[model samples]
Target chain A: MSTAPATTREILIATIADLLDGVRTVAVGASSPIPAAGAMLLRARNEQRGRERVRVIVLGSREHNFFTNGSFELFDATAQGRVDAFFLGGGQIDGQANINLVGTGDYPTSTVRWPGSFGSAYMYYLIPLVILFREEHSPRVLVDKVDFVSAPGSSEGIHRTGGPHALLTSLALFDFDKEKKRFRLRSVHRGHTAEDVRAATGFDYDAPANVPSTPEPDAETMALLRGRVTGELSECYPQFVETLVADRAA
Target chain B: MGEIVSIEALAAQIKDGMTVALGADNSGPAMAATAVLLAQRPKNLHIVCVPISGIQADMLIGAGCVGTLETSAVTLGEAGGAPRFADGIRSGAFKMMDATCPAVLAGLVAGQKGVPFMPIRGVIGSDVLKMRPDWKVIDNPFAPDDPIVVVPAIRPDVALFHAREADRFGNVRIGRQAELAAMAYAAKTTLVTVERIVETSLLADERSAAGVLPALYVGAIAEAKQGAWPIGLAGEYTTDTAEVARYAKMARSADGFAAYIKGFAQRFEAVA
Candidate 1:
């Protein structure tokens, strides 16, 4: 590997890959391209380490996915605890980790409507580990309170095997405190500070003094991400690969 | 016991104001029936989708054939978000009953068994529980003091879907799309469009027997080749991504949607 710079995108992807250390299987959703890339990176690393088989299921890729019933199989597998980690995003997310995939104004009749929660509510409860990924980090998306709760981070009545493990944004990553029901700032990205995160987010969180910057993808990790991971991701996310890989090369 | 009829004749059975259930993503929409429904423009019709719906729902909403939609999500896939559905929902054009995928499937399964309701594990603390007033939370009779969410059985008047192939005796071979079987079983009448009509014994043969839907469930079958055009038929063809993108853009407005759908609906008649 040369001394080429690591993209913030790649760094974030590698971080997510590192999160999948103990996860046996990771299911990436239809709309998630970055998470898909990260899952592939994890698999690549696993193979490089000569570890046990790790299943990475990215929806719409024939080579990666072998389900007959599409999302139905994903839901079933999650319910049975087969899926160890999953990904979710939202139009708006709150301090409590409530995701609002519905939209801006209100229920049934939101002013700005996002796609209705497909199976976020169902999967959030079943999968033991969930990583909330949203690139757009601002007050608009990361809010004090979500307009609608598509899936709640903490719950009582429903039997949930898992909930939000952490929230990864462009600026920083926050660990969800299941006990406190609040986010604890884990680390800020290299280019940004805790104050920058505070200025943008509409919610409050506990931040340690002298917060450490998120580590960039090390030499070998970047190689795995750029080389094997990019190739594997091309089958499903051609546009993404072209934009990130080809354009970067050019 | 009519084993085969024209697609138009089959679509006619879906009267106005009737709630129709469409198949899941892999099984694909019954494009032949969908075309006729668009042409017929039956008012106040309600359609239920298991989870994610493709452009078929957008086309229906655009054509003013649907008064209500019950599904988890509706988008045009790589094409984009369903424009017509988005616009319609914003303008209070119809009713929407948002549900998660499994809840809808569980409802369909309950309907198939003619049961009052089926109990499920999740949805107890989410907004879905609050939005859906009908779905109840009860203490499990088997294990008292434990709360369980029960979904109401959603039996539709008719179930419309497309399959890979069917036998002359009306048995359908849907292969891996087992959810289609659940949809057909839940509806009062199962209307299907297939690519070809095989010998009645083809369904009984050991090789093909496993995927066949019994004749008792299917009320009508039609041979509409490439019936799931633009969308797709499982294991047959991929979705026409370009056409879907065009639909997504065109469906944003009334005139644009009308113009786009005109060609799609007309194309079905020439083949039929």
Candidate 2:
């Protein structure tokens, strides 16, 4: 029997952690610290209990440098192929799975300007199991066509690497329709209706009939995340950590 | 020779073994240059790469253009297990310069500012700083009021960046987080590769262009389309994870890596 319920973050975190099977390497970019830290902490904890260990690898500007003792280099594990999964985020993600971080302009200029592509450009084409997560679910984020494709997705073909297998958000999960060049909702959160998700998205989507609720995190995982992981990251990067905590708590 | 060049022409400026600083995140020009560098295979190009999380660096190290890597993290992907510039350090093929988080940026800032060294505090206790004695802790003479650690100026020979847009004269605007500041301050010459060319005058009036790199700091600017491919633009293309894995797998071995690249090149006639 289920003992306690899980929060949205916990559910998402737990889903991610459980979904990884025999994953040796995981690359996480900026805005993905929470998931990255969760995966690592959970993996380490599991290994300590004589469980299978996942050789967790995180990639980001601050990921390695945060470990004050080692001079973390970008190419330390630069050549490992065993990395099975990647986690990414974006301001706008289209149906083709192409994401945009650059501004959306008319022809040459855009009405909205955004940061240039972070690591998504490369990760989109390189990782096998790519999960594109977004904290917000607005029509603006789930768009029909991106003004710029900061990173190409399935549109380039299988030869092109790094297409998202799943697009996770606060409301639901999405997958790419290669033939249609659009995103389709795979599932919605429990108690949340498909209409709710569609209302938030700018584009039209088709939902699966038998979609299930995302699994929730156990008490231990939540406690660990809140107590140790969040605490450490907050201490390391106060500016970044503070906002995330406030957002999650709110 | 003209100060401004096309993206194709600018690629010629880079040769192997040249010490360069590639921009971090969205501001790096290395993304567009990746294919060119891989094709040319400039011998033993030594790069003090900063914050190596994206696929651009992955392609470089995977293709063997990188010799010495000074970075913070290599992302997990197909190339996660391959012999990388940093891994080469452990294997003794390439050199590794240990860099702390703040020091990484500070060194670039010092070089960008054209200063001999910049004083920083709190890094005195981190082991990363100790290993790099070149990053020394010194008494602040000018500020006899404080204790500080000196981050050596990193002025790499060249600093390369990718801008959203540029003028014929190389005036450019970088978006948020502007991964270029330290690079701009660090390199003797900073090269920019942009998505498109816009009028320099228009930038003067644009809100986003308020804080941009003037032609004074830019050595050259190149206009290239899809220059920042694979790496997703904020509102543009979603990243291709499969391609990242392929590069990672191929980078695992010398023969495999070469074959992998050759195969990739064959697939991208436009790039080749």
iRMS values for every prediction = 1.8, 20.7
DockQ of each: 0.59, 0.02
Residue B171 error, candidate 2, Å: 1.3
Q: CA shift at B197, candidate 1, in angstroms?
A: 2.9
Instruction: Give the per-residue Cα lDDT of candidate 2 at B208.
Output: 65
What are the TM-scores, per candidate, against the unseen true structure? 0.93, 0.53
**Model 1: residues >4 Å from true position, as ranges?**
A1-3, A69-71, B200-208, B267-272
Task: Name the top lDDT candidate.
Answer: 1
Query: Per-residue lDDT for A199-247 in model 1, tens only?
Result: 9999999889888888888788888888888888887788788878754
Maximum-DockQ candidate: 1
Number of the predicted model whose TM-score against the real structure is largest: 1
C-alpha RMSD for every candidate: 2.3, 20.1
User: B1-272 in candidate 2: lDDT tens per residue?
Assistant: 11668655677777667887776543443466666667777767667656444556656766667766665444433224324433443445555454434456667767767778876433333333444668776666765545566878777777786666777666776644344655665677777777778765435676666546667777777765556555544333434556667666666676776776675544543632
- Across A72-188, the per-residue lDDT of candidate 2 in tens digits comes to 222123213345677766668776676775445541233443333444444455466778778788988888777666566563212333357777888887776656766777777
Local accuracy by lDDT, each model: 0.83, 0.59
Question: Runs in model 2 with CA error above 4 Å?
Answer: A1-250, B1-4, B76-83, B140-147, B200-202, B265-272
